[model samples]
Target: MDSTQELIAQGMKQSVPWVRTAGIEFTEISDGRVVATLPDVAEQRNHVGGPHAAVMFGLGETATGAVVLAAFSDVLDRAVPLVVSAEVRFTKLALGPLRAEAVLGRPAEEVLAELDAGTRPEFPVHVTISNAEGVTTGELTVRWTLRPNR
Candidate 1:
Protein backbone atom coordinates (compact mmCIF):
# COMPACT_ATOMS: atom_id res chain seq x y z
CA MET A 1 0.00 0.00 0.00
CA ASP A 2 2.81 2.36 -0.78
CA SER A 3 2.42 5.37 -3.03
CA THR A 4 3.51 3.50 -6.13
CA GLN A 5 1.25 0.55 -5.40
CA GLU A 6 -1.69 2.86 -4.76
CA LEU A 7 -1.06 4.64 -8.01
CA ILE A 8 -0.82 1.38 -9.92
CA ALA A 9 -4.04 0.05 -8.44
CA GLN A 10 -5.87 3.26 -9.16
CA GLY A 11 -4.56 3.47 -12.69
CA MET A 12 -5.41 -0.15 -13.42
CA LYS A 13 -8.91 0.35 -12.12
CA GLN A 14 -9.38 3.45 -14.23
CA SER A 15 -7.66 2.37 -17.42
CA VAL A 16 -7.74 -1.38 -17.89
CA PRO A 17 -11.27 -2.61 -17.44
CA TRP A 18 -10.48 -5.91 -19.13
CA VAL A 19 -8.07 -6.83 -16.37
CA ARG A 20 -10.92 -7.18 -13.92
CA THR A 21 -13.05 -9.00 -16.44
CA ALA A 22 -10.23 -11.41 -17.16
CA GLY A 23 -9.48 -11.93 -13.48
CA ILE A 24 -5.95 -10.55 -13.68
CA GLU A 25 -4.85 -9.38 -10.25
CA PHE A 26 -1.99 -7.13 -9.34
CA THR A 27 -0.30 -8.63 -6.32
CA GLU A 28 2.60 -6.25 -5.78
CA ILE A 29 3.88 -2.86 -6.80
CA SER A 30 6.88 -1.09 -5.40
CA ASP A 31 9.57 1.27 -6.63
CA GLY A 32 10.22 0.13 -10.18
CA ARG A 33 8.70 -3.28 -9.52
CA VAL A 34 5.37 -4.92 -10.19
CA VAL A 35 3.79 -8.37 -10.17
CA ALA A 36 0.51 -9.76 -11.42
CA THR A 37 -1.15 -13.13 -11.44
CA LEU A 38 -3.53 -14.80 -13.85
CA PRO A 39 -5.36 -18.03 -13.27
CA ASP A 40 -5.24 -20.89 -15.73
CA VAL A 41 -8.56 -21.85 -17.23
CA ALA A 42 -9.75 -23.69 -20.29
CA GLU A 43 -10.91 -20.44 -21.84
CA GLN A 44 -7.36 -19.14 -21.78
CA ARG A 45 -5.89 -22.19 -23.41
CA ASN A 46 -4.96 -22.57 -27.03
CA HIS A 47 -6.11 -25.21 -29.46
CA VAL A 48 -3.01 -27.22 -28.60
CA GLY A 49 -4.16 -27.50 -24.99
CA GLY A 50 -1.61 -25.06 -23.56
CA PRO A 51 -1.95 -21.53 -22.33
CA HIS A 52 -2.10 -19.14 -25.26
CA ALA A 53 1.12 -17.31 -26.00
CA ALA A 54 -0.69 -14.03 -26.43
CA VAL A 55 -2.19 -14.37 -22.97
CA MET A 56 1.19 -14.89 -21.40
CA PHE A 57 2.76 -12.07 -23.41
CA GLY A 58 -0.04 -9.70 -22.58
CA LEU A 59 0.23 -10.30 -18.87
CA GLY A 60 3.99 -9.85 -18.84
CA GLU A 61 4.00 -6.73 -20.96
CA THR A 62 1.19 -5.11 -19.06
CA ALA A 63 2.77 -5.83 -15.70
CA THR A 64 6.14 -4.57 -16.84
CA GLY A 65 4.69 -1.44 -18.36
CA ALA A 66 2.80 -0.70 -15.18
CA VAL A 67 5.99 -0.71 -13.18
CA VAL A 68 7.73 1.57 -15.65
CA LEU A 69 4.79 3.91 -15.69
CA ALA A 70 4.79 4.13 -11.90
CA ALA A 71 8.48 4.86 -11.86
CA PHE A 72 8.20 7.60 -14.48
CA SER A 73 5.24 9.12 -12.68
CA ASP A 74 7.58 10.04 -9.89
CA VAL A 75 9.56 12.27 -12.27
CA LEU A 76 7.11 14.06 -14.50
CA ASP A 77 3.86 15.97 -14.06
CA ARG A 78 1.04 15.10 -16.43
CA ALA A 79 3.12 12.50 -18.16
CA VAL A 80 1.54 9.81 -20.29
CA PRO A 81 3.21 6.46 -20.93
CA LEU A 82 2.96 3.98 -23.78
CA VAL A 83 4.73 0.88 -24.93
CA VAL A 84 6.92 1.60 -27.93
CA SER A 85 8.35 -1.86 -28.40
CA ALA A 86 8.16 -5.31 -26.88
CA GLU A 87 9.74 -8.74 -27.33
CA VAL A 88 8.58 -11.96 -25.75
CA ARG A 89 10.29 -15.33 -25.56
CA PHE A 90 8.52 -18.46 -24.49
CA THR A 91 10.90 -20.61 -22.57
CA LYS A 92 8.33 -23.22 -21.66
CA LEU A 93 4.68 -23.86 -22.16
CA ALA A 94 2.60 -22.47 -19.37
CA LEU A 95 0.25 -25.15 -18.13
CA GLY A 96 -1.15 -23.56 -14.98
CA PRO A 97 -1.63 -20.30 -13.16
CA LEU A 98 0.98 -17.73 -14.14
CA ARG A 99 2.81 -15.02 -12.23
CA ALA A 100 4.66 -12.17 -13.90
CA GLU A 101 7.13 -9.77 -12.32
CA ALA A 102 8.82 -6.68 -13.71
CA VAL A 103 12.11 -5.31 -12.44
CA LEU A 104 13.74 -1.98 -13.22
CA GLY A 105 17.35 -1.54 -14.25
CA ARG A 106 19.75 1.39 -14.41
CA PRO A 107 19.52 4.68 -16.36
CA ALA A 108 17.17 6.22 -13.84
CA GLU A 109 18.70 9.65 -14.08
CA GLU A 110 18.56 9.79 -17.86
CA VAL A 111 14.95 8.77 -17.91
CA LEU A 112 14.05 11.47 -15.39
CA ALA A 113 15.88 14.14 -17.37
CA GLU A 114 14.11 13.20 -20.57
CA LEU A 115 10.77 13.37 -18.84
CA ASP A 116 11.52 16.79 -17.40
CA ALA A 117 12.64 18.08 -20.76
CA GLY A 118 9.41 17.03 -22.41
CA THR A 119 11.23 14.45 -24.47
CA ARG A 120 9.75 11.00 -24.53
CA PRO A 121 11.96 8.59 -22.64
CA GLU A 122 12.11 4.95 -23.46
CA PHE A 123 12.65 2.56 -20.60
CA PRO A 124 13.61 -1.04 -21.08
CA VAL A 125 11.76 -3.23 -18.62
CA HIS A 126 12.32 -6.91 -18.02
CA VAL A 127 9.43 -9.23 -17.24
CA THR A 128 9.55 -12.86 -16.18
CA ILE A 129 6.53 -15.12 -16.13
CA SER A 130 6.49 -18.17 -13.91
CA ASN A 131 4.16 -21.08 -13.49
CA ALA A 132 2.66 -22.71 -10.36
CA GLU A 133 5.95 -24.44 -9.53
CA GLY A 134 7.82 -21.10 -9.42
CA VAL A 135 9.76 -21.89 -12.58
CA THR A 136 10.21 -19.24 -15.24
CA THR A 137 8.07 -20.02 -18.23
CA GLY A 138 8.62 -16.93 -20.32
CA GLU A 139 10.49 -13.63 -20.52
CA LEU A 140 9.66 -10.30 -22.07
CA THR A 141 11.42 -7.03 -22.65
CA VAL A 142 9.12 -4.08 -23.07
CA ARG A 143 10.20 -0.63 -24.10
CA TRP A 144 8.00 2.14 -22.81
CA THR A 145 7.96 5.76 -23.85
CA LEU A 146 6.85 8.56 -21.53
CA ARG A 147 5.93 12.06 -22.55
CA PRO A 148 4.17 15.08 -21.16
CA ASN A 149 0.55 15.50 -22.07
CA ARG A 150 -0.06 18.50 -24.25
Candidate 2:
Protein backbone atom coordinates (compact mmCIF):
# COMPACT_ATOMS: atom_id res chain seq x y z
CA MET A 1 0.00 0.00 0.00
CA ASP A 2 1.17 3.52 -0.73
CA SER A 3 2.05 5.79 2.14
CA THR A 4 0.08 8.51 0.42
CA GLN A 5 -3.03 6.39 0.48
CA GLU A 6 -2.63 5.85 4.18
CA LEU A 7 -2.16 9.57 4.68
CA ILE A 8 -5.31 10.33 2.72
CA ALA A 9 -7.31 7.83 4.74
CA GLN A 10 -6.06 9.34 7.95
CA GLY A 11 -6.62 12.90 6.83
CA MET A 12 -10.20 12.18 5.80
CA LYS A 13 -11.04 10.60 9.11
CA GLN A 14 -9.23 13.17 11.17
CA SER A 15 -9.63 16.42 9.28
CA VAL A 16 -13.09 16.11 7.75
CA PRO A 17 -15.61 16.33 10.55
CA TRP A 18 -18.64 15.64 8.33
CA VAL A 19 -16.99 12.53 6.98
CA ARG A 20 -16.48 11.30 10.51
CA THR A 21 -20.12 11.88 11.33
CA ALA A 22 -21.10 9.58 8.50
CA GLY A 23 -19.24 6.77 10.22
CA ILE A 24 -17.33 5.72 7.11
CA GLU A 25 -14.61 3.11 7.48
CA PHE A 26 -11.94 2.81 4.85
CA THR A 27 -11.36 -0.84 4.21
CA GLU A 28 -9.11 -0.39 1.17
CA ILE A 29 -7.45 2.39 -0.79
CA SER A 30 -5.23 1.53 -3.72
CA ASP A 31 -4.04 3.32 -6.85
CA GLY A 32 -7.40 3.37 -8.60
CA ARG A 33 -9.77 1.78 -6.15
CA VAL A 34 -11.28 2.50 -2.73
CA VAL A 35 -13.61 0.60 -0.43
CA ALA A 36 -15.62 1.88 2.53
CA THR A 37 -18.18 0.59 4.98
CA LEU A 38 -21.09 2.46 6.59
CA PRO A 39 -22.71 0.86 9.55
CA ASP A 40 -26.50 0.61 9.84
CA VAL A 41 -26.86 2.81 12.84
CA ALA A 42 -30.31 3.78 14.06
CA GLU A 43 -29.66 7.44 13.42
CA GLN A 44 -28.88 6.64 9.83
CA ARG A 45 -31.90 4.47 9.23
CA ASN A 46 -34.91 5.48 7.15
CA HIS A 47 -38.53 5.22 8.14
CA VAL A 48 -38.62 1.79 6.52
CA GLY A 49 -36.08 0.61 9.11
CA GLY A 50 -33.36 0.34 6.47
CA PRO A 51 -30.26 2.38 5.97
CA HIS A 52 -31.05 5.75 4.42
CA ALA A 53 -30.20 6.50 0.82
CA ALA A 54 -28.10 9.48 1.81
CA VAL A 55 -25.88 7.19 3.84
CA MET A 56 -25.03 5.22 0.76
CA PHE A 57 -24.46 8.45 -1.14
CA GLY A 58 -22.15 9.72 1.51
CA LEU A 59 -20.21 6.46 1.68
CA GLY A 60 -19.94 6.30 -2.08
CA GLU A 61 -18.70 9.85 -2.30
CA THR A 62 -16.20 9.27 0.47
CA ALA A 63 -14.82 6.20 -1.27
CA THR A 64 -14.56 8.10 -4.56
CA GLY A 65 -12.76 11.00 -2.89
CA ALA A 66 -10.29 8.64 -1.30
CA VAL A 67 -9.38 7.22 -4.71
CA VAL A 68 -8.93 10.71 -6.09
CA LEU A 69 -6.64 11.71 -3.26
CA ALA A 70 -4.62 8.52 -3.51
CA ALA A 71 -4.35 8.86 -7.26
CA PHE A 72 -3.03 12.40 -7.06
CA SER A 73 -0.91 12.04 -3.96
CA ASP A 74 2.24 13.11 -5.77
CA VAL A 75 0.71 16.46 -6.73
CA LEU A 76 -1.72 16.83 -3.87
CA ASP A 77 0.25 19.63 -2.29
CA ARG A 78 -0.04 21.66 -5.48
CA ALA A 79 -3.53 20.54 -6.47
CA VAL A 80 -7.00 20.39 -5.00
CA PRO A 81 -9.34 17.50 -5.46
CA LEU A 82 -13.00 18.37 -5.71
CA VAL A 83 -16.17 16.55 -6.54
CA VAL A 84 -17.85 18.44 -9.37
CA SER A 85 -20.98 16.32 -9.55
CA ALA A 86 -22.49 12.97 -8.72
CA GLU A 87 -25.09 10.81 -10.44
CA VAL A 88 -26.38 8.03 -8.27
CA ARG A 89 -29.06 5.49 -9.10
CA PHE A 90 -30.87 3.81 -6.26
CA THR A 91 -31.87 0.34 -7.28
CA LYS A 92 -32.73 -1.93 -4.40
CA LEU A 93 -33.39 -0.92 -0.83
CA ALA A 94 -30.48 -0.77 1.58
CA LEU A 95 -31.57 -3.40 4.05
CA GLY A 96 -28.45 -3.55 6.18
CA PRO A 97 -24.99 -2.14 6.54
CA LEU A 98 -23.64 -0.66 3.36
CA ARG A 99 -20.30 -1.32 1.73
CA ALA A 100 -19.21 0.86 -1.13
CA GLU A 101 -16.31 0.37 -3.51
CA ALA A 102 -15.24 3.02 -5.98
CA VAL A 103 -13.16 2.49 -9.09
CA LEU A 104 -11.57 5.15 -11.24
CA GLY A 105 -12.97 5.39 -14.73
CA ARG A 106 -9.50 5.68 -16.17
CA PRO A 107 -6.27 4.23 -14.94
CA ALA A 108 -4.49 6.17 -12.25
CA GLU A 109 -1.51 6.57 -14.54
CA GLU A 110 -3.64 8.12 -17.25
CA VAL A 111 -5.27 10.57 -14.88
CA LEU A 112 -1.87 11.58 -13.55
CA ALA A 113 -0.54 12.01 -17.05
CA GLU A 114 -3.27 14.49 -17.82
CA LEU A 115 -2.69 16.42 -14.64
CA ASP A 116 1.04 16.42 -15.26
CA ALA A 117 0.39 18.00 -18.63
CA GLY A 118 -1.19 21.02 -16.93
CA THR A 119 -4.75 19.95 -17.65
CA ARG A 120 -7.44 19.93 -15.03
CA PRO A 121 -8.19 16.24 -15.08
CA GLU A 122 -11.72 15.15 -14.37
CA PHE A 123 -12.18 11.55 -13.36
CA PRO A 124 -15.44 9.64 -13.22
CA VAL A 125 -15.37 7.34 -10.26
CA HIS A 126 -17.90 4.53 -10.25
CA VAL A 127 -19.16 3.31 -6.89
CA THR A 128 -21.18 0.20 -6.16
CA ILE A 129 -23.05 0.09 -2.87
CA SER A 130 -23.86 -3.37 -1.62
CA ASN A 131 -25.44 -4.90 1.42
CA ALA A 132 -24.16 -7.76 3.61
CA GLU A 133 -26.11 -10.14 1.43
CA GLY A 134 -24.02 -9.02 -1.54
CA VAL A 135 -27.01 -7.38 -3.15
CA THR A 136 -26.32 -4.10 -4.89
CA THR A 137 -28.46 -1.27 -3.58
CA GLY A 138 -27.17 1.68 -5.57
CA GLU A 139 -24.62 2.80 -8.10
CA LEU A 140 -22.99 6.22 -8.18
CA THR A 141 -20.75 7.94 -10.68
CA VAL A 142 -18.92 10.78 -9.05
CA ARG A 143 -17.01 13.25 -11.15
CA TRP A 144 -13.87 14.51 -9.49
CA THR A 145 -11.41 17.15 -10.59
CA LEU A 146 -7.86 18.06 -9.70
CA ARG A 147 -7.12 21.75 -10.02
CA PRO A 148 -4.06 23.81 -9.22
CA ASN A 149 -4.28 24.99 -5.64
CA ARG A 150 -3.03 28.38 -6.63
lDDT of 2 by residue, 62-104 (tens): 8998888777778888888889999999999788788999999
Model 1 TM? 0.88
lDDT of each: 0.81, 0.86
| TM-score of every candidate | 0.88, 0.92
Which lDDT tens digits does candidate 1 get at residues 1-150?
Answer: 777687787788668876666578888987678898899879989987767998898788778767876676665457777788888999987888999998875466788787778787788889999999999999999888776788
Least accurate stretch of 10 residues (summed lDDT) in model 2?
A: 1-10
Clashes of each: 0, 0
Off by over 4 Å in 2: 1-5
Candidate 1 residue runs with Cα over 4 Å from true position: none
Report how far off residue 50 is in candidate 1 (Å): 2.4
lDDT of 1: 0.81
